[model samples]
Target: MTKIKICGITRLSDALESCRAGADALGFNFSSLSPRAITPERAKEIIEKLPPFVASTGIFVDQSPEEINAICRFCKLQIAQLHSEQYSPEDARAITEAKVIKVFRPEENFAVEEVFAFAEKSGINAFLFDAYRPDMAGGTGETIRASLATRIFNALGDSCYPILAGGLNESNIGEAIRSLQPYGVDTASGVECEPGIKDPVKIKAFIQAVRKTVF
Candidate 1:
């Protein structure tokens, strides 16, 4: 099954709704730069209430390995999604508290070999591909061009688990899944009524759309 991750969760109500709507994972934005950013204490409270089998992911941008690991342990996070370019392969390897997912903001003609090499060097298996924005680290609401995403998926094959992000919603999510066939799909602004707020109806529709395509 293709995984569905509802990212930028700010409220326990929104987190519970996403899980009830069939999200396999929920992302808590820990980056202060993001509008959806939540405090570690708040995140921990929400995570504690989540049902079992649903993964909790902490999104980090520009934090050190030590800081990321500390937050993961505190919140009991199952995954640490690193969204910064500053992290070296060594930094990724150093995150011991939870599984690491390195985010890549790739352009149309990015080198696939570079990504594959990084995965091998970092020993990271899961990667997230989000649209590249000049001033933001994801949550751009811009779609990665189908041709570019499909090309990367084909080049990498099963070497890494690629999760597609950026500009995904109920209307176009099915088409996006059919094109890229990613291991997972992540959405932040896509299913939101506004930044940091989720719309339950949109969340349900979005997941339903993805399921229809995957099965």
Candidate 2:
């Protein structure tokens, strides 16, 4: 089965809703650049209320390992999603403790070889592929090519799952899953009424769509 992750959660209500909608993971954006950004304190509050079996992931960009670890520890996050080109492959590969998911936008000068090599060296848990939008840093609602994402998946060698993101909604998520057969699908703007807020109807429909996919 393909897992569903609802990203860019900002409020307790939205977080709770995503969890109730059967999201396996809830992503809290800690990147200061994002409109959906939330403080560790806020994320913790929401996470604390979650039922067991649901994972909380912290979304970070361009932070040193120290900063990333600090927030993850504070929020008790189960996973860390890194999406920065600033870190040398060495630095990124060295991170330990919580499961790490490195984000790659193939169209944004992100070399597939570089990502494959990093995963080989770092032993990350997964790779998130999102479309590259020049003005926006993430979740721009633009889709990555199925072919390129599949190539990255094949290169991972089963050690890590490739998570498809960007431009996913209830309508298209099933198609994306069928084509890429990713381990999971991530969405931020796709199920939102606006940044930081989720639309309940959309959230339910999105998860339903995911469950309908064969992976």
Candidate 3:
């Protein structure tokens, strides 16, 4: 089954709704640069109310390993999704509080070897692939090319867990899953009424679509 992650959660209501709708994880954006950014206090409040078996993930951009670990500890986050190119594999290894999920925005000519190196060197097995935007660090809602994504999956094989993101919604998720066969799928804007706010109907529909899809 493709694990489903509902991202950009800013409210406890949205978090709970996502959980009820069958999301395996909830992503909280902590990067102040993002429009969906949430404070650590606010994210923690929502996370604390969540039921067991649901993972709480934090989206970070360019923060030091120490800062990431601090926030992870404070918020009790289960996973840390790093969105900066500045972070070397060493930096990912330094984060001790949570599992690291390095985000990669692969372009048309992206090198799969670079991803292999990052995962092998950092000893991190989880990764999220998003659309490449020169001025943005994900949540762009632009889809990554299917050919390139397939190349990545073929190269990585069983070495890493790949989560597909970028522009995923109820209508196209089935096709994306069938083509890429990712270990998981993540969405923010795809199921949202706007940044930081989720539409319950879209959330339910997206999750249901993912659940019905077969790789």
Candidate 4:
């Protein structure tokens, strides 16, 4: 079944609502530039309020491994989503104790082999492919071609799991799942009234849409 991850969670109520809506995971943005960004202390408060068994993910961009480690530990994050271009195998290794999902910016000329090679070398838990835009690491609200994403996933062989992200919503989530059949799907702005603010109705509909695809 395709798992649902609601990203950019800022409030305790929103996080709990996401879990109630069937989200397997909740993503907390720690990237300073993003409007969804939350302090480690605030993330901890929200995470602590969540029911057990729901995973909390910390999203970072170009942050030092030490900083990532510190925040993850303090916020009790189960997964660290690295959306930085400067990530290296050493960085991944440094976070060995924490599950890592490395994000790849989909360039027009991106080669599948290169991404597969990196995933193999880093030994990451998964790969999240986000639409490439010069100024943004993610949360661009732009969807990449599913055919291209599927092709890359098929090429990865048994080395990595692929998670689709970027501009997914209740309307097209089923189509996205049918085409890509990703290990999981990540969303933020798609179900939000605004960045960091989730709309309960949209959250429920989004989860319902993804659940339909799974069966």
Candidate 5:
């Protein structure tokens, strides 16, 4: 099954709603640059109320390994999603707690070998593919071609889970899943009334759509 991850959660209400709506994972952006960014204390509050089996992911960009690990500990996160290309594999492996998921922001010039190179990183549990924007790391609402996503999947070939994100909503999610066959799909702006705010109706529809889809 293609797991559902609702990203850019800013409120406990949004977090609980997405979880109640059947999201497999929830992303809490700790990156200062993100509009949807949340403090470790705030993320912890929401995480504590969450039911078991639902993963809470901490999104970090360009932070030191120690800082990331510390925040993960503080929040009791189950996953750490490293979003910076500047973050070395060594940095990823240094994380002691939560499993690491390194993101790949691929542009038109992106290469499959780049995916292989990042895959060589130790301690990474999965890889998430997102659209690359020159001005930002992710959550740009631009999507990578599923063909590109598919190519990377073929290369990785179950060595690790491949997750797809970027511009995904209820309308296009089915086609995106059908094409990439990713282990998961993440959405932030796609299911929101605006950045940092989620629409409950969209959230339910999105999850229902993912439920209806099959690889």
Candidate 6:
């Protein structure tokens, strides 16, 4: 079954709602530029409130490995989602104990071979494909072609788990899942009433839509 991840969580209530809604993972944005950004202290407060088995992820962009590691440890995050162009194999090697999901910005002339090679060398657990938006790293609410992502995933084979993200919502999630059949689907603005705050009704609807497609 395709897993569900509700990204850009900022409130304790929203986090708990996501867990109650049957989310496999919850993403906390630690990137400074994002409106949804949360401090390690705040993230820890929310993480501590969570029950066992729900994975917490810290989202980083152009942040030093030391900073990422420190926050992850403090917040008890199980995974790090690196959404930066500056991430290197050395950085990945240093965070060997952590599960890293590296984000790739799709280009007009995107080369799947080059991306697959980098994923292999970086030793990341998964690859997230997002539409390239200059103003924001992600949470752009712009949909990309699922077939394009599927082709890349097909080329990369089973070793690289593909996550289809960018502009996924309750209405189109089923179509996206049916076409790509990604390991998981990630959403932020699509399920949110505002930048950082999530709407529970929308959240429930989104999860329901995903479940309908997968089950």
Give each model's whole-structure lDDT: 0.92, 0.83, 0.94, 0.87, 0.88, 0.86
Of the candidates shown, which would achieve the greatest TM-score relative to the real structure? 3
Task: Put down candidate 4 lDDT per residue, 47-147, tens digits, no spaces.
Answer: 98899889999998968989899988888899999898888877887884369988888766679877767766887659899888888878888988776
lDDT of 2 by residue, 1-215 (tens): 88889999988888888888899999999888898999999999999998898999988886788888888888899998887766555666656646788887886344567766876677666888888876676868788776766676676656678888989999888888787778888999999999988999999999999997784
For 80-184, candidate 3 gives per-residue lDDT tens digits of: 999988889999999999999999999888898998899889999999999999999989988998888889888888878999999999998999999888999
Error of 6 at 27 (Å): 0.6
> Which digits, one per residue and each the tens of the lDDT, describe model 1 over residues 1-215?
89999999999999999999999999999999999999999999999999998999999997889999999999999999989888888999999999999988988779988788889899999999999998999899998888888888888888889999989998988888887778999999989999999999999999999999953
TM agreement with the true structure for every prediction: 0.98, 0.92, 0.98, 0.96, 0.96, 0.95
Q: Which residue pairs in candidate 5 collide?
A: none
Candidate 6 residue-wise lDDT, 14-56, digit = tens: 9999999989999999988999999889999999999788899
Give the lDDT ranking, best first: 3, 1, 5, 4, 6, 2
Which residue pairs in model 1 clash with each other?
Answer: none
State the lDDT of candidate 5 residue by residue for 1-215, as single tens digits.
88999999899999989988999999999988899989999999999999898999999996898998899899999899989888788888898888999898976667777666666857565889898887987789888877776677777777788899989999999988887788999999989998999999999999999999987
lDDT of 4: 0.87
Better of 4 and 5 by lDDT: 5
Residue ranges of candidate 3 with Cα displaced over 4 Å: none
For candidate 6, the 10 contiguous residues with the lowest summed lDDT are 89-98
How many collisions between residues are there in candidate 2? 0
